[model samples]
Target: REKEEDGLETSPSKAECSVWEDLTLEKARLELNENPDTLHQDIQEVRDMVITRPDIGFLRTDDAFILRFLRARKFQHFEAFRLLAQYFEYRQQNLDMFKSFKATDPGIKQALKDGFPGGLANLDHYGRKILVLSPSIIDRYTLVDILRAILLSLEAMIEDPELQVNGFVLIIDWSNFTFKGWGLGSLAGSSGAEQDGPVGQMWLAGRNLPMSDVEALYANIPHKDVLQAVRNSIPDTITANLVAELCDFVLIHSYFRFGDNLYLQIGRTAMGTHMAPQYANIFMADLEQRFLSFCPLTPT
Candidate 1:
């Protein structure tokens, strides 16, 4: 009461200041510190650069649309351009899916009804959207159709301001799933027109993506290094070779332990390009089945 009578202005408490600092740190980690005006200018620059680039120009060049690719490439203009180009090229190749695609489209609707992939309306603690896929329930839709659903869902999510900066988390529940088709014999072969089926096509589409859109992969379970140790102790040579090869594809670049999770950063190539974004999806699908095999034993 005496302090108030002396007319001293109230200041925020130390706890409040600490909370503010934490929030700032979180925002910076998510790259949310970008100034709105500056970001808009950057988007405009890219739009102008690609405004007359043939097939790419036909795409919606609004800031919202362009920002997705830019965000995917960490605002790298040329990398974003390459991704944007690849995206359009994919769309062009699959005219039936892209020409008149809709969230309410029959194929997507049926897939949704069958629960091929489902999305949670809630955001993660980091404000990123949550998307879940159940591989076991993927019987109704073609692989291309499934990809289209995912891409379309992502397009819708990118429009949200929260998801724009924070991105999204994809969780695939592989419970009761089986690795069908290509057994060990066929997986080793690198070339064959006959091998190009749904899974193969999906892998090819993923491989075709420019190595700029991926950031890093986060595995929030057991330690990958420990998993590696146990995997080395396995007796079966062929199984060991398959697991090792798959691990090489999934756990590339540097790995750091954060609590129980292992964060695997994508290495930049000599020519300065990141790894393909599709590696995460492809890896997760295979990893789940492999993970089940070595659950009590060790991760494959």
Candidate 2:
């Protein structure tokens, strides 16, 4: 078939054909159900869906902008529409972040310099971009600042059609950080005891406990093992699958920084975010359950 029928031909050149061949359009068709024949039709359908929605007021209805959401959601019109709505809604709700959203903004520039979410030059095995993030950097900047830096990186990256299709891989390095850094009180310190709150009371109680003692309690539970445990424990249902996908999205896109270089946390989940503790607890529960089931004697 000619380039006109397949919708790959933009210009009449042999070089363009070679470039298209190297692109992931074939993969998109096979995996994401993207049809070059119905590409314009799909875009129009999503556009019409957007046009009818009075709630999603004044969104950019251009082909390029609308196509991104469609590509992200694998050409599913409703899912694409929902994602588009959420995209605009997020921007609308967080006006402060988007009001002066630019590369030159001081906070964003600083966050980028600190490598809060650093992009790797090379793509991964699957041709997806790899972003590195350091949770320790989170303490240095406001959540909004860090978010803006990430958004900036993403905005620059999504321009590539290959990236739009292949997406991204985030690696969050949890190293070079402490419990106190993660908002948890120090395990052995008067500093933690000085603070006022339930956290302070809890810290005061455990202040005498040595760090070695804490480490000894779960030193055997490796980070990779915990992730595997979580994966295995999730039930195989539609809701469960969605939850699993969301979790995977979070883990895969996470990245971190150390010194001047950025590193990917290949082993364990980072501390700092609320989700980290929950993720740890879920896997821990799974591990405990497995141990109890395997043990012959029941002991309290």
Top candidate, metric lDDT: 2
Q: Model 2, poorest ten-residue lDDT window?
A: 210-219
lDDT value, residue 57 of candidate 2: 64
lDDT of 2: 0.73
lDDT of 1 by residue, 198-270 (tens): 4554453223211123244433323354245335545687786676566556545556677999865654211
Q: Candidate 2: which stretches are off by over 4 Å?
A: 1-23, 187-300
Candidate 1 least-lDDT 10 residues: 205-214
Q: How accurate locally is residue 34 in candidate 2, as Cα lDDT from 0 to 100?
A: 89
Model 2 agreement with the true structure over 12-42: per-residue lDDT tens digits = 3777547655678887888788898999999
Q: What are the lDDT figures for the candidates, one per model? A: 0.60, 0.73
Give the lDDT of residue 151 in candidate 1: 76
